[model samples]
Target chain A: MSPSPEILTPERILEATEDVLRRYGPTKATVVDVARALGVSHGSVYRHFRTKAALREAVTARWLGRTEELLGELSEEPAKTAEEKLRQWLAVLFEAKRHKAGDDPELFATYGVLIQEASGVVDEHLLVLIGQLAAIIGEGVRSGQFAARDPLAAARAVFDATARFHDPVYAPQWERPEIDDEFRAVCELLLRGLRA
Target chain B: MSPSPEILTPERILEATEDVLRRYGPTKATVVDVARALGVSHGSVYRHFRTKAALREAVTARWLGRTEELLGELSEEPAKTAEEKLRQWLAVLFEAKRHKAGDDPELFATYGVLIQEASGVVDEHLLVLIGQLAAIIGEGVRSGQFAARDPLAAARAVFDATARFHDPVYAPQWERPEIDDEFRAVCELLLRGLRA
Candidate 1:
């Protein structure tokens, strides 16, 4: 085993917790296992997280944040037209989620349970995503590319409209050959709707 | 204790099974409870259902069929324009689901579990709903009302777009005060998208 780090940080604890969760799944995973993985006392882990629930919530937030960070860059690209940015933004989001659900299904399943336990985190993540969409839509409206009086509402509608392409519950269907065609059709419809 | 029915039918068994599920939930609900509720022998219930899984599946189909029957009427209305029909159809679906979720939450929760266990039933129900949407969309396309090349694809997109208003996972949000406004805004956007 690698030597325990001299510093025990929340990030270290969270990283270890993810490993533990993957090893044990959600129901059986424990703070003690995370501590063991980190080669630290449970007290040290608790010192950073305060509680196991807090630790799990943080991990979930971290997982969701990665998607936000990736999409945030696309949303902020002033060089690209808002319409193009919006299209790429959605495509990227769908691909990221598909990869997470496909490349590491065990961890994906673990996060599914953790997400239920961390609804507040998930809610916050959703708001962040909607905010990203709203920003892109607001740009479109200001540029006279879209005809939305309420950019935020329009953004939400777009989000909901494309949910089958990105939502975790529909992950099982994402791998189907027809999903790409479906995604393109949805994007085309939304783009048409947005055209002023 | 009412007198047991002289003859047991699959319909009766399904009805009793729904009551049992409502009372005990999916996990604790059993074929025996259905039999007890109907004041009939377990053998009588089994003889009609063939197995407990079949009984639960039938109950799920029965629950879903109620919504189908309600929406089926809207899809068949010839006098209404396809756009108007599409608008009303989505509105009615959202209302129907919201009522089912709100009117009897216990039964709704019971059916949520039953649905997962009866995915084939759920899949068939989805196809029926999408088919209805496709027919309306095809009508729209033929009449020069909508611009979709693939009515079925457009129908699926519309379904996914409006999911938050009807999907069970988002049922909790359906009761929020602003949901009507949200639903209207989404419908407006989609209606615009379909405009030729």
Candidate 2:
């Protein structure tokens, strides 16, 4: 009789997949490679993900989930002024980049490549991540703490600045302390610009 | 003996390549294809450009030359205030996108694809286009017409915002008037955010 398959949690499989992606980029990260990493057969990997595309999506979802675990705690605090929220939020995002810089350079690069590749597909979960920043901007605008303006564009701009931290070319050259300070200054400038 | 080769002007070759790129994407727009478009042999095309890559670069150079022509004129004109300069500059960029939308759809799309693909390459000339925008921001900041800030970051924000026009998903949906107004508003908001 065929042996029953070993049970591998989705999280464990995802971790292995991320490791595989880090070692070999998206083009080379195959089910066989992932299965080898997990000490499981290819069928086990296939059970969790039907195709490579599905696997890639799951890997990205896993990364976002971790980002949420890192960022989700901030939004729970009492609401604050736009400047305060923007400063704290940019710090949170930058810290995540720093954390990855020390822990997993390849994975960080892989995540960026994946995000850029999937940007047009409109991942709902990623939007939810962005929505937290958007909510802060909305609160600022409504409270008259920020100038009346388009929250979505403002949030996107802030996100873009912070996201640059993930770029190896720019991030290494940049001083984090300076970038954080500039983040505050830039956010304040935007809020003042938006003032009704 | 081989027939004596006829020489074509660099200007004439670039024009033919642009026409070919507009008709077909970079991958399909081979030297042979360009030569056929110009009614010359592929060998003649090779005599002018060593490879397809060189030809593609020339095509991109031609596109940038036109953009630079407009930017050069705008830079020389004095704006009384940072806000006015920012708004007028946004209008100029959006107007260029609008003009391209009418004239050469494939060329614009291919340009975007090539730029994105060549993003990290040192020889990529996309930076020259962005540098012009950065120079304007730096000049504004130095002149004290703009806020004391990181001109590079501010420039990056403006470029990111302008990219909305280049998005394939949103391009068809874009209303010229709405984009022009939106760009103007966004630039005003950014300038406000950048202020001292």
Candidate 3:
């Protein structure tokens, strides 16, 4: 039988790193720890990532890549109003939390670190995405699809509303299958807050 | 000189604990840490609280106590509109972050924890406060004093908007001295979104 292509690409490595981060935290996770989880040799990991920091960077890149995809989908979606797009984004975030791969310990540990780096490094892609969202909001205001106000400021508030989803404090309580109702309540509130 | 009761009470202990928490996270903070910071002996601290967990509970109580005070102030702020009260609540949260006392690390860490806890354990209180905000909103809608929408849902949106002020992810960027401008903008958008 033909061998399946090796799954240890840089992206896959980063995914494993995210799992390790979630399971063991940055302080405890090691190259061997990550390799064992990925079913690869420690030396194989070293071939692509020379240091833990390098691997972390790759993982962060992967996360941003995912965020970018969501943003792209948001921009591409045929939502008629900014409010609809905002709701779409909220749905994406909620699903991201819900659909988290089971092996996401390293990703969880690295999650905080990634967010901090994005803010500090002026995560340009995030800024671009924010700016795009703001533009849509501005268009909504001009088109009388939303209230006329500072689009950028409104965009920030919407982003903050999603922050609660990432919180471990609430995430645990939200693990129940029935929590979709609460999630819908939150999303509806944001949409109502954004309505024209 | 007379000791004059040493000028410390359970209240003072709780306040000092907040300071210690701001300096160190929950892991590093101990009753002794609070004691030393408060300029009191370990025996005095033990006299008031027998264990670290007890002290933490007191700290949590104090934090809730402060939130209650803020809620009281909002109720009496003479705000003519729900938007006005919402703006005031945003200001309260902003102030909490800006003036978190004694470099309180534990208090800081626990703030998010406390928020989540309130949602679950203190749902009645949260819902009541939200209901009150909704009443103001309903009044505004009736008089054409503000945008007309489902006041209860809008009230909930206002609370969710405050989630920004509580999130640490945007702490550095959002907790600026002049957040009032951005806050006002959000209020304006929400008001517009609710406009009939």
Compare the candidates by TM-score and give the number of the best one.
1
Backbone clashes in model 1, listed as residue pairs: A161-B161
lDDT of 3 at A18: 78
- The fraction of reference interface contacts (C-alpha pairs within 8 A across chains A and B) present in each candidate is 0.65, 0.30, 0.44
Q: Against the true structure, what is every candidate's RMSD?
A: 2.7, 6.1, 5.4
Residue lDDT tens for model 1, A1-196: 5686467877777888888998999999998888888877788887888788999999999999998999998876668898999999999999999999999998888898999899899989999999999999999999999889889999988987888887787888888998898898888888888889
Q: Candidate 3's error at B118, in angstroms?
A: 9.7
Give the runs in model 1 whose Cα sits over 4 Å from its true position: A1-5, B1-5
Candidate lDDT (C-alpha), each: 0.87, 0.66, 0.65
Q: lDDT: which is higher, 2 or 3? A: 2
Q: Candidate 3: list runs displaced more than 4 Å.
A: A1-28, A32-50, A77-83, A101-122, A135-144, A147-153, A166-170, A176-196, B1-51, B79-82, B101-153, B167-170, B175-181
After best superposition, candidate 3 residue A179: deviation in angstroms?
5.6
B51-162: candidate 1 lDDT, tens digit per residue: 8888788888887888999998988877889999999999999998899899998878788888888889998999999999999999999999998888998999898788
Range of the 10 consecutive residues with the lowest summed lDDT in candidate 2 chain B: B117-126
In candidate 3, position A182 carries an lDDT of 50
Q: Cα deviation of B80 in candidate 1 (Å)?
A: 2.4
